[model samples]
Target: MSDSHELSRRDFIKVTTGIVGGLIGAIIGLPSVFYLIDPALQEGGKDAWVPIGKFEDMQVGTPYPFSFTRVQVNGWERTASSFGGYAVRKSDSPDDLLILNSKCTHLACTVNWSAEAQAYLCPCHDAKFSMEGEVVDGPPPRALDIYEEHRISEDGIIEIFFKAG
Candidate 1:
């Protein structure tokens, strides 16, 4: 008795073709899909030292306002964020430069240098810092956030590592 339930040649070829086709599709398409999503899966918390301006541009005994745009790589996207700070050249020497973040330590409000008051004034919570980033008055836990890593480039540009808190 021949209980034949074996597959025909045509059916066998069709099944093998389908498996092979699927594998080829995966080999080609999978990498494209991974590449598209790779940026999104990358770590976002990274900071770099960036040049803000020339060391000579900062006037002696005055806090010079500086702003720069940098790309922040976050999950799934690259965003351009504007960051602001102050460059203080106490003297003619580039080594005397002090780079300070403009954000107040009290509540992260933007602080402006006040010539009349002779202090960095945070209008949001009335926090004041002296020309040397010391707490002057009102409510602030510590001094203004100062860039710890900074240097004058060979071209005399003031560069500093900006880290967002």
Candidate 2:
């Protein structure tokens, strides 16, 4: 009877140790496993200069297309994505350039320049914005999104900083 009791006690300790070890392992390893699976869950927004290219190529009063890449991290996985938009050099006056985001403010639909209407039009909701990006009509609560832009040199090379929401 004594030997049997000792064996039972030893088995109980082994089972308890295994349970505690598994729990501790899960607590530490689960997050790492999740991070490895998705990296975007880790953090948001990295500051990077978006290149708009040679300023000489951009005609005054005309919208120029620019493209840039943004990295999204879920947990430990990172995905690279590209975004394209148009910018207009509205004025030759000092720092008079405007970078309009094509995304409509109402429901994030793409806004297109309506040359005939002389406005930015969002077909999804009929939102309209003036050439200057002011909200002229429709469901948009505010003006079209504008990006901060500055010329890298007097020669017309420009760089715009875009913040990812």
Candidate 3:
């Protein structure tokens, strides 16, 4: 009964060995785990000058649709999301352009241009927006969001400064 209540020498050695082994494993493994995942944990640059199309390709008074993919890495995951928008040339001048995000302000549904109706129509709701991106009717609280910063590159490619929030 006394022997059963007391820890044997072999049991003490086994317990101490397990604790030391576990501590050693954690000390070595934790840093290695962090090192392996450090790149994924760090945030990547989301600001970029995204090329839409050739400046000449965008016709005046017409909405030219364009799309691009943005890849974001979080932890061990990599997600690629596609975003689209419309670019309208207001005049022959390279600076005279209107770049609008396709996402409706109300519910984020993609808005399509109605050539016949001459407005952007949201399928989710009956929201209407003018060619100039102003709200014409329906549930939208404000005008369509525009990419305010844009430039025509020296190669004649139109690019908009895209910044992710």
Clash totals for all models, in order?
0, 13, 0
**Global lDDT of each candidate:** 0.83, 0.77, 0.90
**Best-performing candidate as measured by lDDT:** 3
Candidate 3 achieves a global lDDT of 0.90
How would the candidate models be sorted by TM-score, starting from the highest?
Answer: 3, 1, 2
Residue-by-residue lDDT tens digits, candidate 3, 81-127 = 78888998788776788999989999999999999999999999999
Best by TM-score: 3
Worst 10 residues of 2 by lDDT: 1-10
Question: How do all the candidates rank in terms of lDDT, highest first?
Answer: 3, 1, 2
Candidate 2 lDDT over residue span 114-156, tens digit each: 8789788888989999887889998899887777654466666
Query: What TM-score would every model get versus the actual structure?
Result: 0.68, 0.66, 0.73
Question: What are the per-residue Cα lDDT tens digits for candidate 1 across 1-165?
Answer: 136689788888988999999999999899989999987676665677888888777898789998888787666687887778888777787677778888898888889999899889999989989887889998989988778798778887878886643
**What's the true lDDT of residue 70 in model 1?**
78
Off by over 4 Å in 1: 1-41, 163-165
Evaluate model 1: give its TM-score: 0.68
